[model samples]
Target: MAKTVLVINSGSSSIKYQLVDLESGEGLASGLVEKIGEPSDGHYKHEFNGEKHELEEPIPDHEVGLKRVLGFFEEYGPSLKNSGIVAVGHRVVQGGSVFPKPALVTDKTIAQVKNLAVLAPLHNGPEATGAEVMRALLPDTPQVFVFDSSFFFQLPKYASTYALNKEIADQYHIRRYGAHGTSHEYVGSQVPDLIGKPAEGLKQIVLHIGNGASASAQISGKPVETSMGLTPLEGLVMGGRTGDIDPAVVFHLIRNAHMSVDELDTLFNKHSGLMGMTGHGDMREIHKMIAAGDENAKLALDVYVHRIVGYIGNYAAQMGGVDVITFTAGVGENDEIVRRMVAHKLSPFGVKLDEKKNDTRSKEPRIISEPDSKITLCIIPTNEELSIARQSATIADQGDSYGNTFTK
Candidate 1:
């Protein structure tokens, strides 16, 4: 039997999971459970061996939702008892400064994660709940919490620090703890192998452009600067987030518009970005609208491309120079138009996109820049689950001692 790791990403009302074979880096099974504790019926779907099974019922809490997941695993196949599960990895969005890397879950660490919920109120609580439930159910299995902020935790002080009052900033633990770090770290690691360069001296920028986008600049396989800050909302304009907005806007809305903080939060996090500008968050829909001569949609694309190109140039300069720029995640991988526009804007940097290569699509990593381009552009699919699994398994194999070293 092959050793496997189960990676779980729990949200406020959903749980996304995958069981990956550690040796092959292939997901043997994956599934999702959604709508937990909602007024309506909850949903569960499990896939294994190219087959999918779904169920709808009331899932009262993470415990119940996870129980159903295990039940499905038993019924469908790949019995957890038989499968060689080395560790259960949970994706915790906010590790704060306390957790600089993935940590082995314990009663104490679980409490610590819950406390950090203040930083990621919408994410860490549910994630800890899921981890607690999984720990209870799988008493013998090692459970690791892989943090989204971990990869950027070691960022230079200048890059992570904010230009705010030191007293208040220190008290609040406010700094640039970037999101999508697992994706960025994983993609950055692959660059050395793909580009036939050593990791030590390479300068790279990774664009993880998903529904929630973030960019990072890595020098010698370590992050120096990243787009996201104290919270994910501080980064690139996302599907619904009004990223990098002036802080005064909050006070302006509160005093002039009589908007409550909660209302502004909802507006910025849920109603803004491409959705706010074009009335559609999906890029594909935006493209269709642009084709239909919708000026708003066209302008939205321009703004989106502009923000990305700005970050690329900013990161390049910050790193002194960039050798490879890799695009990953949903938008970065599939949306060639966005890539084309961003690449063309970088003609000054000698970024020459191979039009033919950019048009062709593949799941595998490939170079999208012309052979003679000054900077190499690549589209590498990010596998956060595999990255989490591998990290989790390493810690598990070395026992609690390995994880303790990282925590210190």
Candidate 2:
């Protein structure tokens, strides 16, 4: 029997999970448990053997959510008792500067993740909760952690720095630590195969646009710069999160508007971006609203694409020039309007959009750049769970790397 790796991406309100065969790199089962803590709208959607099933249940906490997950496996997995489960891997958003790569999860690792919660307030908190629950439920199984900020570990010193007092910034470890790293790493690994060249020899820009968006510039397989900084909010406009706002605006809100720090933080982190701009965060709905003559939706779409175009241009200049520009994630892979709009805005840079190709849906990579365009444009869907599972299996083979898994 083939060994299986269970990958879990614990979020504030949901968990995205998959079971992959380590040797063949094939998904055995994959699904998501969404809207936890709400009785009416919460459920687990499981997909296996080309079939999907949804079960409604009340899950009040991460522990309850995870128990429901295990219940699903008990009823659906090959064997409830012995299914050859080799390892479990988690996607941790912030590992601080300590972890440059995926590490086998340990008690120390869990504690370290907890310590870094302040860095990624929304992500690390739930991830640590999920880790603790898994430790209790699956005591014998090994768990590994893949840091979301690990890919930006390659950010050049200049791009990573902020114009702040050296002492204060150093004490706080305040520098750009990019997010959506697994997606970037997946793109970087696949670039050589897709373009038929050495990855280390290319100047590339990866636009990972989804609910959360970011742009990263890679020079010779190393990340020199990225749009997201310090937090996930420092890049291109996103669904429900504000990106790249002037610092003065915060001060004005605090002093002139009499807003508290907590209020200011929530304003930018929760109630800003496309949601704040148009009252809709889902790009598909925003696009629909625009077509239906909603001015706010139209403006949000314009601003979102404009920000992406600006980043592409800036990265092109920073890299001297860009050889290839690739788009991945939700909006990049499926949103035709976003793809065309962004490519059209970048036409002045000798990047032309192939309309027919841009409008099509393809699981395989499809280049939407005009034949004569200088910059190659393509869409490559990201697979982060597969990346985590592979990393976990490698670490599992090299036992003792994560100390001992919390032995009961």
Candidate 3:
């Protein structure tokens, strides 16, 4: 019986999970529970051994949804009880400053995570709900929380701090708690090995470009600077996010447009970015519009690429120099145009993209930069679920005493 870890990412209305083999680093099974607590019947899909099984039924809550998930595993292929499952890992989006690394799920920790929901109202609450449901449903299995902001928790004060009033900032804990850290950490860790270099003093920049994108600068595998700030909305222009916008725009909208805080929030977070510019958020669709000579689409592409290039240069300067630059996540891994534009823009920094190499589509990590290029450019697919599983398995093996031990 091979040991495995179940990784769960609980969204507001969905629960995405994967059963990963601990020794092989392979996802043995994966599934999604969707439309949870919705008016219509919720959907459940489970995939294992290359077969997919789906169910459509009312799932009023995370508890009911997760119960159906366990039932599916038993009915389909992998029996949870016989699969040598060691731990259940939950992805918590906003651990805030409370969790610097993955923490074992407990009554107190669950409360702490829920308390931090003030910071991530849309994410943390539901993630905590999933954890609570899983802990109760599988009391024998160790439950671990892998935070998306954990990697940037130890960022240098200058990088994490905003120049806000000291007393107010301290009172509110306003600082850059970057998101997409699990992906960054996982991709950053792969750079040294992929580049055949030592991790001792390597300076690397990880561009995690997806629907919600972010960039990070790491030294010796630790984050020093990242694009995302106090909230995920303060960084790179994303699918529908305004990214680095002037704060006064909020006040202006409130006063001039008579918009409420909720309306402004919706505007910046859900209606801005590429979507706001071209009425499309997906990069592929934007590219199609650009081909049809849509000025808005062209401008949106330029803006997106411009923000990414700016961050690469900024991270390089902040780290003194960059040894390796890796692109990961959805757009980062698949979008050759974005990668090409960014590399071309960075040509002044001796960043050269090999046209043929960049054009080649590969699922495996490969170099897309020329050999003589000053900085190494490569594409490394990120596996956040596998990362979460590995971390959770390590902590689970530390015995029953592993409580709040933060990974340094």
Candidate 4:
């Protein structure tokens, strides 16, 4: 009879979901539906109570894919009909500057989010579609949108603004609205818990590296600067993104290569990054190629870690000093080599990652720095869904803004 929250992360071709009991901080069920509407095949994979279930079916659209997810809940376990779901929290990739906190989804809010699609076409459009479907299916259920960009809304103006014509920039709403905010906020807050100190005393740098990666510098539990800019593609070199590139390259590709705007978009957003450099995006595959003496993979790994290391050093200076450095997300949490390589290079900066702790495979948060290092290093696995659920529940319960976010 415990109350729960259903969290949904809608992607262009996938929906990642979880049902959790907030009080227990335990996920009751979670799964993903991939390749939805793909001409070849669609897949549904679900996990409950340590068991896995999968199915293949022609899911023609997002609605069907969503239905399949709920169906799996019924077929597997933790039937939603009796789970007492208080709210459904959706992870929206871009909320623009309009929303500084999780929003109670309404028709008006949906329209507002749709208008912001221009800033995140690959994400907002699809997310809006999924929201529409969820509304139609669960008309009476209270739904909240947890934006990935909201946590960076208060980034220092100097860090968020670009050196451009303020008039034109303001008109176009062009500013550094960093993404992966939930992860950054969650990890930053958890650092105090991991290190047994109050958050107010911590100046921490959080690395949320995955297929898409970003870095955030949080001072006194708030973001001062972050790597991702106006869009996700502007940050670290990701699995398929050309990050930190010269803007003129777009014009060059369009004029010199005779590529259209859409082609260049796909090229930079989809065909670039690790795969573009080394022909594979998954880190595990890249490691295999590296072991086989693939120079491209080796260079890719170097380039990847180099971006991360540079950001850590820059953040340390930007914050005047750093007390802790934390890693989260896919690569930061699991890739032992990545953590070690970055830490080894940062030894001069008081980042002495303990070899044994760095290699520990457990997902629990723990310090990875040497006992005598001046700066602390640890791993805090991000739970964005739970963060969203907590935010949503808090808002629904008393309309209180969790200290994690602030407005201009």
Which segments of model 4 are wrong by more than 4 Å? 399-408
lDDT of each candidate versus the true structure = 0.92, 0.85, 0.91, 0.87
Per-residue lDDT of candidate 4, residues 1-408 (tens digit): 888989998888999999989889789999999998789789999999999999988889999999878888888988888888877888888988888888877777788888999999878877877878877777766777889999999898899999999999999999999999999998898888778988885799999999999999998899999999888998799999988899999888878899998898888888899989998889999999999999999999999999898898899899999999888999999999999998889887676778887887997999989888989989998999889999877665554343222111
For candidate 3, give the lDDT of residue 1: 83
Predicted candidate 2 versus true structure: per-residue lDDT over 1-408, tens digit per residue: 778888898998999889887777778888898887775768789887788889877778888888878887877764425657777889999877877777767777788898899899989988988888887888888878889998898788899999999999999988899999988888877877887778776999999999999999998878988998888989899988889989999888888899998898888987899999988889999988988999999989999998998998899899999999999999999998998888888887788888999988888876788889988898999988888888787776675444543332
- What TM-scores do the predictions have? 0.97, 0.94, 0.97, 0.95
TM-score of 2: 0.94
Q: What is the lDDT of residue 347 in candidate 2?
A: 82
lDDT of 1 by residue, 1-408 (tens): 899999999999999999999999999999999999999999999999999999999989999999999988899978988899989999999999998878898888899999999888899999999999999998888889999999999899999999999999999898889899999999999999998889998999999997899999999999999999888998788899988889999999999999998899899998999999999999999999999999999998998888998898899899899999999999999999999999999988788999999999899999999989999999999999999999899877675542452232
Which candidate number maximizes lDDT?
A: 1
lDDT of 3 by residue, 290-402 (tens): 99999989999999999888888889899999999999999999999999999999899898899999998999998999999999999999999999999898877773333
- Candidate 1's error at 114, in angstroms? 0.7
For each of the candidates, the C-alpha root-mean-square deviation to the true structure, in angstroms, is 2.0, 2.1, 2.3, 3.3
Error of model 1, residue 207, in angstroms: 0.2
Q: Using lDDT as the measure, what is the rank order of every candidate, best first? A: 1, 3, 4, 2
Clashes of each: 0, 0, 0, 0
Q: Give the distance in Å from residue 355's predicted Cα in candidate 2 to where it truly belongs.
A: 1.7
Q: Which stretches of candidate 1 lie over 4 Å from their true place?
A: 400-408
